[model samples]
Target: MKQIGVLLSKNYKLLSVAAILEVFETVNKFYATAGDELPFELNLLASHETIENQKESFGYQLQSIKDVKQLDLILIPAFTSDNMHETLQANRLCVPHLISQYNNGASIGTFCTGAFLLGASGLLNGKIATTHVDASDGFAIAFPEVNLKADRTVTQDGRLYTSGGATSSFHLLLHLVQEFCGNEMAIKIAKVFAIDMDRDKQSYFSTFQPSRNHNDELVASAQQKIESNYHDVTTIEELIKDIPSSRRNIVRRFKQVTGITPIEYLQQTRIAAAKKLLERTGQQMTEIIFNSGYSDPKAFRKVFKKSVGMTPSQYREKFQVR
Candidate 1:
């Protein structure tokens, strides 16, 4: 069994810690039955036993971690702070013990602003990590040694796993559980949580947001329309007309901001919409495809499999109308 450690700090947001705790605890319950065996062990690590309260966002207290050495995976939960020093104080032991843990082959992980603490620890030098977009500048200025990718929800460099924000913590944990336990357990947990079960290491991060500018206003407008009306049947030419920009300019700026062409983005959005419909509606595959802006069943199946690792029928069988 993999030994998991959650490093709780003073002022750490309650939901972040609670979410991680609840998920893992539920996983542990799977093993309580006579025929089931769990794949993980978890512990909460804190610097002190002074009866500290959790961060304001969620109301909870945490257990102190007395022995950091035996942990197989160490997770740092997100906390909000404008001042970097204040954030560090609650979980400062992470910095002093990180290198030693790495040398001994322990996996390091974090969620949201937890990446900021990893950066300060000097353990993330040259590693790819992500934090909240607002923390991007401060993280870069504080830890130029680490390569920060502001847009991603989760990034891994070797054994280090860093996540972006609050909700993304579920994705990060599920990914780790998948890595250590198996895909079956991941699917079971996801179904229990009513999650789409489509997330992977790369599937969940938001790449970039289209910026508003005079030159890119038309492109931004088109993107906004697409997002707002993802269920609507929108073609490339129609999108350009709505934006009032030339096809060339719209494509250029849209790709510049979001790292994909306009058509690609539309297809992605449609697939996302289809996933939601699959979870929420009892619609047939053909109807779901049409509603998600696809005209051909074969083509929709191909695209769904390519983007989400499962065919429409397979997705429905596994997750929808269940």
Candidate 2:
């Protein structure tokens, strides 16, 4: 049997851990019903020792990470919250154990913000990874050495795997199922879970929510300009025209504060507007483009496809309000 260890780390989102257990349990049940021996030994790896005294197995064996020396697979669940700085600090002791398991050829997969903990282990350095689309900015800022593929629904580098936010975890779970249990088993589980296994990208679900976590009024001023006039302003200069700072200085502070340049902020704002129009109304392409501050249809389509991972028509078809 494959030894599957799901880290019941502190601050772990309960739903994520439950989902992981549910999938593996279903896998085991599938084999057992076919009169085959159980295929997986699902173990919840807890950081503390108190779990051993508890009797809430729910069909999963809880083992202290300190006692477990080997595992074939390790699944890290999303955190209960997005404050990864504190979340990682609380789960610091699990990192060394993860690194050891990974080095010993065990595959590691993370769901949503759980990638932060995996990234903290330095295992993702130079490896392609992703987290929640909204949290992508923070993840990129925190782990500059890692290749952050924010648009990808699921990414696999060697044995390390990462997924996008929320429901994106289901896609990665299916992927791991397919990898170990074959395509047929994965598809069966997908049908049971009602997951769209063909979803290749998570970019369409993204919103351009600009950060207001910084104290720089100049940056806030630049953001105000971008948000208020994104439908008309075409240049970063226009967004900063009234701000009392040099372009270079504002650009640096903007990147430092918002994790994106003023130009990108404006582009995203325009995109957000366009997405809203497409979703809420049956707006024509040219009209939407102009209203989104773009005059060139071809340029806008290129940018839309590049950023949103789908053409405007496709996005509309998928998400248009009926």
Candidate 3:
């Protein structure tokens, strides 16, 4: 049996761990039911301290990272905490272990924010990866060397794999199955799990929540202006008219603090407003477009489609209140 090690990282999400174990266990059971040898041995790997505390709770053989010298595959579960920086720090013990295992030819797959822990190991440097859609901005800012493809449902760079938020994890798992077993086994798993294998871009599921964790008052002032006036203007000059800082300074500091340019921020704010209206209102398309500060229907449709992966009518048809 090929060895599969699932790292129970600090603040690891219970559902993520459960899903990883269940999928592989099901795969193993499939072979056993067919009178063939089991294909995988699932190993719960964690730090020594965590192993002692969670061993009995997991009710499975838990191995410390120090004892796991070789693994054919490694799975990292998403973290529960919102502060991924602190969570990553808590899981620093896994960093060296991840690097060593990858060097030994073990493939690594990370689910949701679990990519943060893997990215911390420096193996993701220059590799395209995706994380939870909401965490994209933070991921990009934290690991500038890594190519962050926030819209992709899954990304594979050589042996390293990363998936987007939540249910997106299953797609990555199915992909691994395809890689190790075959496409037929992957299809069987998808059928058993009732997973729609058609998913690709994750953009449609994302809500544009701009960051508010910075202390720059000037940037704050610019943000307030943009949020308050996003519905009435298009140009950055018009949006930041009341802000005392020069346009150049505000743009630099705003991007520095928010990881997006002022124009991009304004577009996101407008799109957010439009999304809310689409979800909660019976407003006409024309009125919705006008209220969201777009003068041209074509431009609004273009931006909305690019940002949301659907047309305005399609978005409203799927999400509008009855």
Give the candidate number with the greatest TM-score: 3
Pull out the clashing pairs in model 1.
45-65, 46-65
Candidate with more favorable, higher TM-score: 1 or 2: 2
**Residue 66 in model 2: shift from native, Å?**
1.9
- Predicted candidate 1 versus true structure: per-residue lDDT over 235-255, tens digit per residue: 777656756667898788777
lDDT of each: 0.72, 0.89, 0.90
| lDDT tens digits by residue: candidate 3, 1-322 | 7899988888999999998888888998889999999889888898999877777446677899878869999999999999987998898987998999999999999999999998899999999999999999999889989999999999999999999999999999999888888898899999999888989878878988788999999888888888988888769998787888888999999998999999999998898899999999999989999999899999999999999888988988988888
TM-score of 1: 0.58
List model 2 lDDT by residue over 1-322, tens digit each.
8999988888888899888889889998999999998978888788765485763455666788777869999999999876788899899988989999988889999999999999999999999999999899998889989999999999999999999998899999999899888999999999999999889899999987788877999898888888888887678887787788899999999998888888888888899999999999987888999999999999999999999999999999999999
Q: Residue 39 CA error for candidate 1 (Å)?
A: 2.1
Error of 2 at 224 (Å): 1.4
Best by lDDT: 3
Global CA lDDT of candidate 1, please?
Answer: 0.72
Instruction: Looking at model 2, report the run of 10 residues with the lowest lDDT sum.
Output: 49-58
